[model samples]
Target: MTLYYDETGDTKLPFESLSIAETVIQGTLRYLESPYDAEVNLLLTMNNEIREINQEHRNIDKATDVLSFPAIDFEVPGDFSDVSTFDLNPETKELILGDIVISKEKVLSQGDEYGHSPLREYAFLIVHSVLHLVGYDHMEEDEKETMERIQKAIMEYLKISR
Candidate 1:
């Protein structure tokens, strides 16, 4: 799996953000039983940049902790049964999973607000965003419960705590 990460501005992450991102992504893929190698793009940005992206992409006009843009639209959430050859990257053959954009400012604040280390909160958000890349959503109760369960399992798999 390849995680393409780019950080904009200097929000100063509280931890080795790339390492944590890689570990959580790997754990998430394993927990979901995804057979194909994948590629995920991650962007770490500050409040102003995140707000612009949120407005441009989601029309929210506000900053958010994280935002996910999935490459594949699975017929069934977290099920790769429908993946086709065309979904693979031409050269590497890695599935184009999706992109995740996070606001570093929110990570620190949320961590303090929730009484956890910034590392834990950052890992949680990445896990949540990865779930979205794999077609998970929380718009409904059952979906929310299922996603929560999967997230908890992945967090445990990574041994990350809040």
Candidate 2:
């Protein structure tokens, strides 16, 4: 698995924290039966940066905790074998999963709001974003339940609890 981090304008966040996130992400991918040759880009930035991104891409003015931009389009709870057909990076020859942009401020704030540790929230967000990268969504009730179940299971598997 290949993981990339972009912190062009962030100051308060520790870039080293992403190493744990990468582990959680890889664990999730393995749990979901994704190919070993997978790549994902993670962006950790302030709320303003994420707000601008949310506005530009999703037409929302407020900052979201995380946003996933998937490279492969598939049905929710998709098959991993189909993932082999996704776009690959020319140099690395890895399946480009997609991008996950997370707001560092929201992670801290939401962790307090949700009564979970910052580490748990961070790992949860990484797992959630990985699901999105693998064509999982929770826009509806059933989909939300399924996604939540998988997320909780992955979190449990990683021994990352709230």
Candidate 3:
């Protein structure tokens, strides 16, 4: 799997190290039980930058902790047990999973508000975003709970506590 990471937020705040972040992302993918090789981008951005992106892509006016733009439009059975059944990227020969945009400012503030370390919050968001990239949503109560359960399980797997 290829994880392309970028940052565009305040540089002063000590963000999660790239290696740790990559591990968390990879752990999330593994938690999904997917075996397909994939490529994804994780963008750590600022509030305003994310707000602009949210407006442009989702038509939402405010900045969110994370946003996912999936490359494909399909869902797999349960934690992606059948991920290999999905189509592959013709050129890359990898599953073009998608992109994840995270607001660093939100991460900082939410980490403080939620009484968790910024790194933990970052890991949580990465897992949440990956779930979305793999065709998970929270449009309903049941779906939301299911996604939350998976996210919590992944965070636990990463040993990131609240």
Give the alpha carbon lDDT tens digit for every residue of 29-127 in model 2: 888876657889999888899999999999999989999999888664657665544377878888888999988888888889999877788889999
Q: Across residues 28-144, which tens digit of lDDT does each residue of candidate 1 receive?
A: 888899998889999999999999999999899989999999999988998988999988999999999989999999999999999999999999999999999989999999999
Cα error, residue 57 of model 3, in Å, equals 1.2
| TM-score of candidate 2 relative to the true fold | 0.91
CA lDDT of each prediction against the hidden true structure: 0.92, 0.84, 0.80
TM-score of 1: 0.97
Write the residue-wise lDDT of candidate 3 on 101-144 in tens digits.
Answer: 98888888999999988888878888888888888889999889
Tell me, by lDDT, which candidate is best.
1
**Cα deviation of 16, candidate 2, in Å:** 3.4
Clashes of each: 0, 0, 0
Model 1 misses residue 2 by how many Å? 1.1
The model with the greater lDDT, 1 or 3, is 1
User: Once superposed on the true structure, which residue ranges of model 2 sit more than 4 Å away at CA?
Assistant: 8-15, 84-86
